[model samples]
Target chain A: MATINDVAKRANVGRGTVSRVINNEPFVSEETRKKVLKAIEELNYHPSSFARGLASQNSYTIGVIMDNTMDKVYANPFIYEVFRGVEKSVYEGGYNLLLLGKNTYQNGKLAVERVLQGKMVDGLILQEQIIDSEYFKNIEQYNIPIVSIGKLENRDDISWIDIDNHMAGYMAAEYLYSRGYKKIAFEGVELEKIFARERYEGYKEFIGSKGLSVMEANELLQNIEGVICLDNIYAYKILQRCKKINKKVPEEIGIITFDNYPLAEYLQPSVTNIEIDLFQLGLCAGSEMLNKLRNRNCEVNRIRIPVSVNIRETTR
Target chain B: MATINDVAKRANVGRGTVSRVINNEPFVSEETRKKVLKAIEELNYHPSSFARGLASQNSYTIGVIMDNTMDKVYANPFIYEVFRGVEKSVYEGGYNLLLLGKNTYQNGKLAVERVLQGKMVDGLILQEQIIDSEYFKNIEQYNIPIVSIGKLENRDDISWIDIDNHMAGYMAAEYLYSRGYKKIAFEGVELEKIFARERYEGYKEFIGSKGLSVMEANELLQNIEGVICLDNIYAYKILQRCKKINKKVPEEIGIITFDNYPLAEYLQPSVTNIEIDLFQLGLCAGSEMLNKLRNRNCEVNRIRIPVSVNIRETTR
Candidate 1:
């Protein structure tokens, strides 16, 4: 039941000073901030999300737009990890989270708009592909800040936190070639998303630079070989079909995929793929969004999430 | 782009009737409901979460209390699936989501207070264990509606949607016994949560009912044999320690865990376990919570999430 006035009085500071410290405003001196924090701790003061949202208009709440309807894949795990990282930082910074939508539904934009126009959240973290030009066009009308998880090819206007997918692709191809596997094939979404194109570019560049001919057939398109994709069940189909192709994995042809999913290892041949640092990506995105909310920085933002290749039994 | 009035006029219903239908009021007749639905479909009208929350003082947003800090485990693909299910219904219901915190951080009443007092979310879907008594006691003060993924023991007053852990445990034990395994053990939390107790009870009942004398040493503490779990991590530590302890899994003793984690398969002799219908659980929870919210039903509550045993290479 202890109020802010009680903490302010006990901390020997004005209510405004206490509010400044609580808001994490930089104006309060370090000594005052410490005293205020100590007093808050002593009082066990829990700030309400609405009150915070009202006072600062910085709900610290980020609108995460995920295509939840997509099949649970390695890419999803990566995204989830990134979400964790972002959640960690957002919580530490004292922010609430607003999960927008699972990309399959068109309602995600409505969720975002609610937060934007209704003043529910401060900023948004969009992990979904901006395929709906109309959605984006409507979104562009509002000045609500957005930090897309992955970079978009044509939409350079939006801010995004992404991994160096191009470099990851190059590394995978180079690593496969170095391991004495020449006929390396890449698999995953062939969408215009930056990760896909960047990965393809990296894979092709690495192979071409080595004077190795990258076969056209090796480039698997959005359609996987015999994989049955039933609304986000891509991983199983890709693995099952790969088994039927009479292709000896790693021995005859090495395969690399973008986004490391959980079932990756459980697969028959076990997939060796690049793992994007989704946690760090989320953390960076959350932090950047927080920073933007604190200061209306409208400049174009692009954050690169780190990637690590999991050398598994699949690659031999 | 179409307004609610436009839809109402097209459907030949009052604007209030359209609103009631959109809000999912049960009083609307099926004929009128279909008309409103057709109008909505034809118009492609989207309801914002804020408008819905403000109009009814119900955000249609649920606070998902999950142990996100824990390592992503393979054994519990249900978590992801449940999340997907929750996403499906909640999104379709035009509700947003907010992941509250991991078990420890949101440990006691703080989590409940945040959700209840803050009024950020209309209802809570506790995805984690409800172990802390003080937390529950504090939560009772707010009078906010709650829908738990796990059971709240000894408190029949609250609403929750959970898996039949006892049945799941009974099934697992019976499966092991039927497979001709004489000695078997269950691994889970040593908390006040209903799941841990139910699973343990089931394990004991099945074994004792069979006239088999179960040894106490066979039961692993909160820490499973060979796993050094401090904060839901060190999952591989258990398998590594098993290697050190010379307790060959599925050979000398059989193991069954409650929640399936990710790295369960990577270990030699992948774990045999039951999978909670997390998606169904989530969907049901959302559906039930929304129903309760609308009807304010007090007497009829409590939903048991169905579970299935996933027999992998682990069980002998």
Candidate 2:
């Protein structure tokens, strides 16, 4: 219940000095700043978000524009994991986070207007599904520092962070090939999935360069020894098919899958997987956004959190 | 990019009138308000967060005070489910959400000061773990309208929403008893968990009133026919113990558990469970907060979403 007057009186300074300290404007001496902070802590003085913003014009908040719908965000745990990451780092970085959206949802981009025009936030961390020319222009016009969660292609106007999908795919195949599997095949996913396609291209590029035929699971009868699956469910089905065909896994077939194979360890032949740390992706994006805010002249940075392989009995 | 002057000029009103319309003051005539809105739509002028707040003094934002640590939120999907519910409804209701927390994270309560002192949010949604006497007194001083996610016993100064744990337990026992199981037992959970204790108390009260003795899972050898587990893993363990003891399931030994038995359907005999929709809890909390905001004189509301039973093979 203490007022600014009380803090000013206790600190032996005028009201203007206390207001300046609270607003974070320069000109107060170190001694005066300490006295004001000490008074604030002792008296439990607090200021409103708008009161501070009115004078300093800094909201000291960040906005996350989730360009995906609620359905997609709910279906994918990765988004929440990313949120967990972004929230932790940014909360640690001394900024509030505003999840930008309107009451009547309109694909998410419409939510950007309020945040941009209101000066509601210091910066933004975007989880955009696609970056078309128009969408990119809308964001660019704001001229604020932004860090995109997923990878953006061909432009370095702002920073972006994602896992190296091609590298992950290449490594999955290389790991299998290195384990004495002569005929390694890649399983199928919908060709249009952006991340999956990038990984598939990586696997294909590796297989093609090595003169290996692009094969599916059904072709295990054609003497295929290893099958790397982009999807975990596909891996399990292949495992089931291998069992029905009387092929002994590891001895005759080897399987490796991407992460999030629920109860993957419970399978008769437990599946090995490439684990991409989504939390780390969010963490890097958060800190990167923080870095941009701290240094206005910093160059556009490109970051990719590395993936690790969890080896299990499927490749044993 | 349109300025207030441009919108005012377009509407044939002075800058002050346009500002007044944007500030949402009631003094503006309905006709003038309509003109300003139309001009704003045509010009797409956005008032900054501070500009609107300078006169109206409302932030138009709500604060979600997650009193638990980041780790707990990450561990419990229920928390995130509630968040998704709260976020979806509130966003649809046209209020932005501020997840308030400090940089160092002195737990979640420390973040409340800024939101409370600054009038950063119009109301609050709390996901608290423990409500000690003194800890709550600090919050009570703020006098903001609050909606707590879990049940609050004996205090109705504000509002609280949760599943009816006692009813859920009573229903589970009644279901088993009505299904012709003469001997039933309740499994164990840590004694300190509040919700679990209430549920167990309900089950015990039902059984005691019915003249049946309280029994544990291992007591099944002595003619205990059905076991209701508070935890899913415990239920799975009991299922495994029955298997090892050569007891047939559903035919000779029936079992049931609470929801979130991940892949429960994949078991030999799928487990039956009482499903509590956490998202519903959040939705009610959000709408309740919105109701409180819309009507200052509204009564303190108590809401409990009912639980649904998933009848599977384990209880067949």
Candidate 3:
């Protein structure tokens, strides 16, 4: 419960200057105003007794911080399902979500600070793998609860609810194998994060430990009988390349992909996809966030929602 | 500013119950708690003086309300582009966005009231057409500003920014004509709102006034020389139908669509689309909300962002 006096002292400015910035009045220089704001953020100062109390109290708002840029996030169908699931759970738990993108690198190192500065939300939901080291830096100080959508090695302390990416990858390979394709290869983006890496690791483990054949893209088209695409976009692109080269599917090669959205079902020959319940993952994440809100220190929970294969024309 | 007594009297409960509810204590009856919460919401009551002042003051938060359900809204790529634009403008303006879906009918009437109850946001940026009549129910009393993404005949009073849908329709027909297609037809979903209708109306106007030929999906496939798909999904479906029937694009039948994202560029012969700057529309919508926040009683402004034709293999 920091007051205006504390803000003024920390900012090295007069009490009147602090009051001016708090009241949003004129006569305060930009430098002085910024200093006051920084101090206020640092001290978690609220102008009135209630504002200060509200800082420690419940706002009943849950925030979502997407680690990826807007283009990457919005273009994919994964968010739509996951967010809807979250929305369903949050609303059911009497909470509303604040959407934030991590693209605000210059504004603040971590977007989570925005809510902490205002005491705007009781908890937060982090989507995707935690890449930036700055994300959970002072998370303990603010005492805000967080739940991740995907599991990573570095994000061990946080309560995470995720669909088993490793299992999903294994299932992609197994599905193609059952379709009678013997020499299987895996296709993935050149540079990817932990979740994508987990998928590749899972696929690699299942593809036979001894004498692994060449599995890269060009090699995949030439040497492999079937290919498991790690990404939906990569799957679509491979299909395009195959078509351009006049390679016949299920005859020359068998193609299988995971979590294809907005297009895979409609893509010509209608892609054979491993449909993941991302919506279920989102719903569970929201429920987990509520659990964190209602009962604090109730042991960090780890959950894995199930996945299944949606067989289509790409595979025999 | 509402006092605790106002809430107590209004809720027909003792001051202690009201205080308990305000402090989020246990032992209050669910019925009585609902009454107190409703009373608090209706009266805009805050327990502390600073909380009361903060309610009337700027929360420095902007909200985005999508009037559609999760499945319908998330399946489309429009939200990704639009919201990113809103995020850009709002962050630059030093504000954060609260994302709300209108699917909470049983929980509450309108999703916008969730923010208004706590004075959580200074303004809101609405995505898509306003279908629900209850949206702006008590907007005047709240004094929070709003900017809409699309135009509906009913939502004329609110400040709105939109792409030229009618012009987009006309452009689709014009593009087909330039590509040597004599007859053009329009395909849309069975049920659509103002935005979709506006596109059809614009295309119809451009297709010729006297004795318009039958332009339904079946008729377009058989009789019509070319077809302008209203929705991106419809465009993909039409292309799939063409592939099934062995209809060669730009030769047997020309095809054109609007605002195709994530898939249109990848859909085989690809797709010629009318590209709308939905992100820019969102940016302007956010900027408009800021302007409204800065200068109250400002005249409402309706802006139309420009559009362009992305020529692809679909239409020669």
Candidate 4:
């Protein structure tokens, strides 16, 4: 119900300036823009959304698709920090986020297509498991910008934000090896996810180069001492099995994994692993998204968040 | 762009039947209604939102306002699971969720009020912290139905869903005693929060029953051999300080805390703590909100989620 005049007064700006800002006209300085936004937010102004939509042809909304829904792994502070960064950037850019859960049934295409067809969002942030190249083709037809958090095989043109999975795996293996761990094992999902594959490759190559044959079980999961996991759940399962085999972690074998989920530390001996800077990933994604929304050209793309090895009771 | 006719065809139902189902008119059987809704969701048919808005005077949307934007303890799997449960129930009931982050600025009332006045939502799910009471009052004026995940000290009449914090605290003390931990400490935020204060009282009373006195650290902290913490960060800091003073965990002292954050498992020896059923909380909140929105005479409020102990490597 608040008019432009009230907003202008509260923002300490001229009425015409407020009008221009409301119209989203160019040439307004960043300081003036901040003032207008602050006043608008403070006054609880709801601009005629219908009118703004007709004039600007933009919705100022982004759709975020995440694979995990309210599980313990998503409870990690790292993921939340990234979300905070994403939220902060979006608020500053005057965009709101709509979260869509990943439909394991592959039926969520309805929601995705609806948002696209209705123009409900200006962009999409995909955080699901890595998909094949064909899925990218399907998404590309929508013509809206998308930024994926996980790598998609055989696709490089699209924007993505991820962590260096290969290096993280290498680091885990090297760290375990340096601590005099000879027998180790890797445990993760059987899925063909890009992250999992890359980390597996890294672990394999590093161990192979060290003149040691990677052991394996004669059946089921043959020939593995140290364990590399796809997620914390699988890692926990591996731990339970290790106890059955009388293999104590970091004593007879070592363990490591990606996506330092919250429950990792609570496990006995505490799983020492690498930590991804998810906040930086979200910040980078949001920045690129804002640029895409404003039609501004930016060189940012395919950013990889760094990782750190969190040494705990699991290793030593 | 898909119409009711498209949904009807996909569902193999008549157009008239689809119309009746969409409008919630009489004569449709429960079985038929389920089929129609499944088809509608599958087709992503947003059935006459404009018409529904005009006729029913309600938007099929609910706003969720959450506190603690930082990943800290708030990122517990319990919180996310609750949200997931809420999401599933609401979407099935034909409602979309709008997530609003707690704006930390000094003047956040305006933003909170805007959600109500702007007609962006028909109801609200408020997750409040101790410091956000002023903003809470501003939103309460709209008199729209609200269900909170946590309780407000001053507002007794509002509907809320919460875990039994007092019982959880009592249980933490009991767990330590059963484990032969005689001396105990309590660490959490300043005693302004109800959860912290209540939990501490529970611990004190239970320990006192066993004829044990809690050690005091001058004025800074209540020093004991074991600890029941409010959050992981405080638990980490407390444990670090305890180590500096030559107090070893589980060996010299035992520890328990409320809210098992993801990183709790990754910490050395992991952390033994109380786990609230967050998913059930969300489901209960969603179910209650739906009931309130559907019926005018429904006066039921105040639901409590159960909590459980996640026994990990922290205790003997």
RMSD of each: 9.1, 4.7, 15.6, 8.0
Q: Write the per-residue lDDT of candidate 1 for residues A122-216, one digit (tens) a residue.
A: 67777647634667666666667777777766677777778887788788777777777765455454655556667778877987898866544
Writing each residue's lDDT as its tens digit, candidate 4 over A1-316 gives 6767899999999987887887789989999999999999888776533334434556666777655534543443455456656755665566666655554221243445544555556788776452444544565676787777766555666677778887777777777778876555556635476787777766777788797655433223334556666666566666666766777766666666666665446445567777777767777777778777677454547777777888766666
Best by TM-score: 2
Better of 1 and 4 by DockQ: 1
Model 1's alpha-carbon lDDT is 0.62
When 2 and 3 are scored with DockQ, the better candidate is 2
Tell me how many clashing residue pairs each candidate has. 24, 5, 0, 30
Interface RMSD of each: 6.4, 4.3, 6.2, 5.5
Model 4, B1-316: lDDT tens per residue?
6777899998888988998997789999999989999998898686544344434557666766655455543344456566666765665565666656677221333344544564657888877573256766677777788887776666666678888787787888889888987777666635787777777777777878889875533233334557777877666666666666776777767777787665556445578888777768887888788888888458858776777788876677
CA shift at A11, candidate 1, in angstroms? 5.8
Candidate 2 per-residue lDDT, tens place, B1-316, comes to 6778999999999999998887577789999999999999898777766766755777878887654345423245456567767876777676777875322241243556655666778888885453445655676677778888887765767788888888778777877887777688888755577678777877888898899987776644558788888866677678767877888878887787776533345444668888788878887888999999999889988887898788888886
What does chain B score (TM) in every candidate? Answer: 0.68, 0.85, 0.73, 0.78
> Which TM-score does chain B of candidate 3 obtain?
0.73
Q: Is the docking of candidate 4 incorrect, acceptable, medium or high quality?
A: incorrect
DockQ of each: 0.17, 0.34, 0.16, 0.15
> Could you say which candidate leads in lDDT?
2
Poorest 10 consecutive residues by lDDT, candidate 4 chain A:
A103-112
Q: List the residue pairs that clash in candidate 3.
A: none
